[model samples]
Target: MNRARHHRRARAFPLAMLLAACAVAPPVSARVQPADAPADATKASVASEIRAGVSGKLKDFYGPRGYWPLWVEKDAIGPQADALLALIASVDVDGLAPRDYDPRGLQRLIEEADASPTPKALARADLALSKAFAALVADMRRPARGIGMRYLDPEVEPRDPDPSGLLRAAAVTPSLTDYIQTAGWMSPFYMRLRTARADYRARWGDLPGITVPEGVKLRPGGNTPEIALLRHRLGLAQGAAYDRALAARVRAFQSDHGLAADGIAGGQTISALNRGPAYYDQQLALNMERARLLPGPWVRHVVVDAASARLWYYSKGALDGTMKVVAGARESQTPMMAGMIRYATLNPYWNIPPDLVQSRVAPKILKGASLKGMHYEALADWSANPAPLAQSEVDWGSVAAGRSEVRVRQLPGGDNAMGRVKFMFPNDLGIYLHDTPSRDLFAKPARHFSNGCVRLEDAQRLGRWFFGKQPVADGSAPEQHQPLPQPVPVYLTYLTAVPTAQGVQFLPDVYGRDGD
Candidate 1:
């Protein structure tokens, strides 16, 4: 029951921040009907507002075919419009603000219609509602700040989900909401987390904070006064005893939060248990934002969950295997990006990055003391086409002093940094997945030791899968490159929570990238 106590204000969204409000509508002069407003007036206002302020891609989509009202039938709000409003209101379930999608002027129109209003107001409402509906669908389909906010899918350009097409289909379809929901590519993990959040907010959200001593450690079959507080905090009924049931609950909580499920309440597990409802809610919110950037299902792919330092392989959209990984350290964080693995290289050489050379290797090797099993190369220049210089011809002091540019490369050998192979997915960031000789580091609970690239423990297996043949394990003299039978997409993502058999397992944010 020991939990950190902090009050968090509920996030506020101003109605003025609604994007639909920025649109300009056509002037309506005559009285309009709710069920059968003037078709021409509705069309004019809807097209003008959408084209003027919705989004460039959407605007271009409708512009080619005269701005027709997508969600209006008989000059009134159609079934599609009704379903859209319902979905917008419940967007909060997905950690999005419903106010962001509220249709401008729709409320006023509803009031006026009740009070026997004129036709022009009704026409204005219909048009505004249609435009707002279009904007909402667009937002729901992409990242919050648009696709540009995403670092993972940088190459995934923002292609507008043609709202006009969706509206047309939804108009004739009875299951409009269900059809629209299909467009979102939310994973099972996200859906489960959403369910967990809703359940937490409903039951124990208002419970009084309970404190557990920081140094207290409780094992199974051990009795302490804090057991009562723990039962109450965990929603157990009063008069509960510190028995096997209490131990089971503790183990479940630890497993869900990525702690060792030993049924022992230690300081780390206590801290995780101590997190209040708001903390969980905020984590879910931030993760939802990260999920928005992810691409949809792929038949076969690789995913690196940077937060957990794990690599997952999927076949036919199902997770087939996984392995431990070493991600970037805190100062040099692994970035979120997506690319296609086109090839693999066996006996790959490690061309040391200049920054690492200047900061680490140069400082140690400058004293002219050769390190064990270390190979240093002096280059004519730091450029890609640098000429090689023999070890005896180069002055180590001058290279260390920055007076001369030297290229430091470790040749392919038993002790090479890139153990036996490296997977290449060409990207501007100079990051890739490769093997590391320091395989023992992967056994650590937190594996954030790499400079920036991802180090894989199962590089040989991955190589075999990609190349359709086993890689040379002996670190042969010449490096060999083989293209994959077919390119497989790789997503380097940062997801902290994933649904497991036990529950939603929340991994530690090794990179400290989770803003919450």
Candidate 2:
């Protein structure tokens, strides 16, 4: 071969080597990108999917939008999308927005998926929503007919709405259950729905308080906010077929939770009851913990679903007894833990927490001086009265009182504020389950009251069980406040999802604690 031909052959050989290397070399780039590079992927795709489905839903439910789904792109969907996306960011979900998230070269999260709570819940919610919609679509299939059909059932009986069960259904499913088991649904929207529903049922159902307020339109499944306020005020969401039984029970609950005993669903009564479902779930989780505590041959014991604002004393695997109780007010949430009541207190002292004294009690004493109603003792001097300023001495005749350093306390007795007796199951919170002189509060459909203690109904019966009452009334009550050899340990817990009393009852969450 000539010199020129040899040179050409060498050049061709080098080109062939370059091609081979390109084909076999391992990749060095660790960035995540689409086969088709960036182009408003997150916003465009997610919005397209959500809007297409959600728009149809809004149109179908509210009728041609009727000015409801109007401006959905710029107005409606935008806000919801932003909230959902912000939540996604909080969960550290992949592809969170660049404006707020950093594009760090971290390996993709694997089973660590188990550790992150928010993402797990969001994923569960998305899956459940998808599954439920699919089921509904299947339920209302075409049958080889035309387009979609079946509007919201107007003929459907307008009973109290119950969405907690809906949420429970989704959470209990094997796939979504993981989220339920760990974090649980606690968004403020859920609480709003829960409390709003309970409020209407308690207020609107009353006959005497029935002036039919505006915005009180009754829906098919649950009560509206206006409806709840009405029923709660009217004393209408009265009772079921067991009114007689419940009335006596209501009186008992009122006595237990510190409400007036008028057998009416007044503000106090409603406040003492209508807690949302989150509270009860806490109760369930705690009970599950208690179940864990008694790993031995534990047959019978009284269980207080404090978060559910109810109690069950069991013997021989049956509900031998039950009670209606009011739990901690929103500010002083009940603690979560386990304990056993070795005894019950006949009369109890209402120790005022420093926060309550400084915030609420002081303001009330300064303004209207209503200590007689709640049986409060204006502490003339908590710390030796550095300059004791009781409401009496501070001449309310002239003074902007929201600023005064007022302190108060209530002694224990029949009207001693804690009522006749208290069931003890001590926990770290310094909170307990007890009785109250004001018993009417339990009549309302919802309950959220007290600084952070639980008031019990038929305390004497609760007393009986702890005292070793024989035959432990399986369906009635264990026994009323009776003889006690030693003090019983009482635990005041905060739980909202409960499955007792009337079987899976939902409560109102007045304290606005869904954020927690």
Candidate 3:
């Protein structure tokens, strides 16, 4: 047999034995107490009920431990049980329905067990709490279609927690409270969403709505009657004329809502103002569902949020720095994806995509546009070692008409489309993070002006974060590949509602992917 087949059988052997042991183990009442020696009748009765109530994975977990209570001791609910119940009661903060976990029913069971201290009541409460925890774990890890988790493209599958493994770990933990709180069960990003949701509800859950009339464009130095309504809606002092202070507040509001921060009360800004706390709440809930698909916090990784046009670098599981990024335009929308960045390419060539060359470049060249300053070179074919050809040798008309094909590349230089360097993560989708020569676009508030790839604002800074120092070319080679000491995972996600220090900032769904 092959080595892989042998390895599979080797790993399956122990699992089979463990399952058999769990299936054949004697009941806790029989193992823990003999027929004549029922010194602790209450304990024996509770263990027997617990064994009869649970099945499947829960049975496997409890049977091996003599059916002992996980959440009760000495006929009283412990601190761990209290903590779990509280979290379940307020689980809406995590975009979860509290009723699904039945927090009220669990509480009633706990109260009855506390008052009468009967074996049946205690066993029921213990089983209920364990089942609630398991349900929570399953919900947090899996993306639910009912909660707006249906994506156009398949996302990176989240790692699901093992039920038996979690129970085993919780059984021996020193502090079950700490274990439930910080057990790496949910994604750290999801926790951030929870905090944002709670803060938003506390601050603006009941914010009164006051809509400004349409077609009212209030500039900074203009006097208008509509300015009064705008100021009131923004929570500023009532004013009749548009002034610098009101403009500044409007600009801040516009920035937070993903509008152009030009201090002008235009159509888009006024429309956003009309959408009060209800719209924001829906955004938070949708984003929380999206966060469910993200992996747990990593020691070293990069997160590129396309909706916000931003990038965050995490080192040792802490945010090291953030920078601006230019994502794909609406026409070529950037996709949500995740992969490991294995290396960096210095002085990289911008190999134009066939579609771009056929649609954009060939038409221009056909109209007598010079390729001298463009630094473009036409190649015979798209191979590792392709022969160079003059621009005039190719049939531009045929290429532009989609009747022919050709390979084109731009030499490394200041005017090259791909500026300086590019981080490579090989995938089926031809998308990677790279620098750009057009730095002016970064100044715009809504920066969505790329074909599909992500353009970094500070490529050198990101390079230094990846490799202790920036990788430099020797000035003699056209392209140089530098492998990283350790590969870092990069998650490209689209979060329309992002958490901020003050509260959640709702960004524009530029790609219209949010379905809001």
Candidate 4:
């Protein structure tokens, strides 16, 4: 019930020794070398091969330091290597393939080092360790190509690694996993979602499919073929008949699917019931892939899940509040991107997009609609000529036909489309969070009503959260652009399956983004 409270507990930091260890690890050059082997002889040969096999920016990572061994030291596997091996092996718990990070090769090298105890054996492990470490880092921060460009593409900066710095920390960190967990390993939310995956995999891993009769519907007390199938599908007691218990299950099922919690199995509910475990597994996997794309963690941030039509505010690495939001419709789906909220505009002007001007307003003006209490100017005049133009002076036909351009802006007031406030973040797509006149839309189960911008039900509250001051209701003359004391990162994500206090809630994939 208290989602924010639960989030705080989930994101609590690990032990203090862990933090100190990460801070105290010595630089790569200062690390101790094997006693018998000269540092320049075989180390140079192994480092050269590592440069060839590692390739790319990573190959040059050790060029300045003469390609020193990262994982092995003193003719054996060191603390850093042992810690990295364990972390790579546990990647599966985060929905990542451990093999992709070369756990098998790392294990074999460790075995060889234990048997031979030679500088050559140690060198081989060092090379594999460096390559696997680089691969893990890359996979953690960068998303797959298909998922990144699925919607309005995000401007994601490639994670430029500091190989020496990371190696230094790995050497001293008490737990390498904990030290790197918040870096680029995975999003904190992904850790929470993994619990849901584990729960489903344990209970319904081998569930069979349920077939709902095409034309039949099952209500609380109905006796249809579909009802019998549902009872069996849910795995109720073999001889037990459908009754109040069955109704409770149906209501619970509806709640999980983001539908009205009425004790009825309608077409939508039946359709969901018909899906087997494979469908859920695929959904979980796809969402996990999506989570892998996030670059890194932010101490304070805002995360908007367009699939669920909700925004969660995270302050100081914990969920502080949640608000309902209206996202872009299916046709013009909201994009998945991350940006920082730099400033808030009070009583903001709604500069209508060109597409809206041509599609919605030009036709209305042609039909003799009065442009009362709004500002209008030709786009050409604003840029080149600088002259005022009356609504009647412009040719609506020319504007609609793309022969001419006009700029339509709505003055801030009660009826303005952008409500009273808007949050601005610089991005190429020009999409941002703003208040809406259609406040009632937030009450709907699915709030996909915007064109491309996000409509917040609690925009004023968000303003207070960002600036520590709320906007005034009166339509002031000078628009206020207040800078936030601390800019907060905002991530717009598309996740269909997320864990909650009760269980995992499966949201409708409004954009049909789930590739499966």
User: What TM-score against the true fold does each predicted structure earn?
Assistant: 0.63, 0.35, 0.67, 0.66
Let me know the TM-score candidate 3 reaches against the reference structure.
Answer: 0.67
The residue-level lDDT of candidate 3 at 124 comes to 91
Flag the better candidate by TM-score, 2 or 4: 4
Q: After superposition, which runs of candidate 2 have C-alpha atoms over 4 Å from their true positions? A: 1-300, 316-318, 340-343, 355-376, 380-407, 468-483, 486-516
Write one digit per residue (lDDT tens) for candidate 3, span 363-468.
Answer: 8898888555468888998787899988879999999999998998889888777898999887766789999999999999899998879999999999999999
Give lDDT per model, in order: 0.63, 0.40, 0.75, 0.67
- Residues 194-224, candidate 4, lDDT per residue (tens digit)? 6567777666565557676655567766665
Show the colliding residue pairs in model 1: 3-274, 31-119, 32-119
Backbone clashes in model 4, listed as residue pairs: none
Best by lDDT: 3
Error of 3 at 450 (Å): 1.8
RMSD per candidate (Å) reads 11.8, 23.6, 11.0, 9.8
Predicted candidate 1 versus true structure: per-residue lDDT over 256-287, tens digit per residue: 66678998888997777678656766776667
| Candidate with the greatest TM-score versus the true structure | 3
**Quality of model 2 by C-alpha lDDT:** 0.40
Candidate 2, 1-516: lDDT as tens digits: 001110001111233433432332211221124642222222222223333344333323322212112111211121222332223333211112332322121101111212331222222323333333223222211122221111122321122323333333332333342332221232221222233334333432232432334422232234345444534433545422323443454454355333556554445554445433334334333333322222111135444444467766544323467778776666665544445554455545566776666666656656666666776655555563335344566533222344444455575545666666666554556666676777887775555576667677666677667675531222322223433564433323333433332233334445443334
**Model 1: how far residue 474 lies from native, Å:** 16
